[model samples]
Target: MEAATKPKLRVATTSLAGCFGCHMSFLDIDERLFDLVKLVEFDRSPLTDIKHCGPCDIGIIEGGLCNAENVHVLREFRANCKTLIAIGACAVNGGLPAQRNHLSLASILEEVYHAQHGLVDGFIPNDPELPLPLDKVHPIHEVVKVDYFIPGCPPSGDAIWKVLTDLLAGREPELGHGLIHYD
Candidate 1:
């Protein structure tokens, strides 16, 4: 009789309010992705192109919260994921999107829509179809419990791989000095 193989772990990922740089870095794993697939299956990620997240063993989220939609997604993702990792500076601290926090939303909207040189009928959008913007951007931790954080503008593929491997082995993830980076 053939030995039964263990089921692969299910992992999902999403981006909320920043550039998709972190996901780009994840792609830096390159051909190692083939190896990764042997141990895990992607769920609700760009890899799978699945819109809704089902229950998952791990969820990797990048970017910060900037709107009601983002909050809803984060909460739903948290509920569906057994382990959630917040990756990149944006997910860790609100990153560049949080720069808008220094200014009032009204003023920013006014300047962009009403005061700009464009001569058309400029007004703030009030359509219910639009996701409501938040007063300030927020890190994922502010709105949901996060199991782990990978700190970097976009953490290198090696760092991400290390953390993932450690978790898969049921060990605490530890980054060496060489793997840790801010750029």
Candidate 2:
């Protein structure tokens, strides 16, 4: 009965190959946040990460796919998250950093270390846990099918809140277009 007593919205948010600005923006909901705590439980995210994605009513994913780990996480998110939402430009079109796709890996490294920073060390440690940078960054949809998308480099806090609340009520979030388009 307690299970039914609690609001039945379970939500999880994860950050992939992008900065955590999107997640931080979601946190900026401030006073409105406790409302979600009563209605929805966060299953995985930097905020309340229990490691695994777990099963949830909705999944909010920020960032793009850049390497093997990203592919694995994105797929897992797709499997566990019932209503998956791709949050931010990184999830939509790989974002600005993805522009590196236009250049070679060696060029990128050389520029970052040898040319720009003028560092002698460009060697990578061969730790098993460390991820090797991929040839390019990729949008989440490129790797998995997404149920919805919230566009913006880092979507406004109001945007994230509206989506979550609407989804919780089993209503289709009214997506405003022009400057903003919910996918």
TM-score of each: 0.93, 0.88
- Candidate 1, residues 1-183: lDDT per residue as tens digits? 111287889999999986889999999999998788888899998767799889999999999999999999899899999999999989999988899999999998899888889847999998999999999999999999999999898999989999998998899999989888766
Cα displacement (Å) at residue 150, model 1: 0.4
Model 2 lDDT, full chain set: 0.82
Which 10-residue window in model 2 sums to the lowest lDDT?
174-183
What's the C-alpha lDDT at position 29 in model 2?
90
Instruction: Provide the clash count, candidate 1.
Output: 0
Residues 117-147, candidate 2: write the lDDT tens digits: 5467765345789777779999988878898
In order, candidate lDDTs are 0.91, 0.82
| lDDT (Cα) of model 1 | 0.91
Clashes of each: 0, 1
TM-score of 1: 0.93
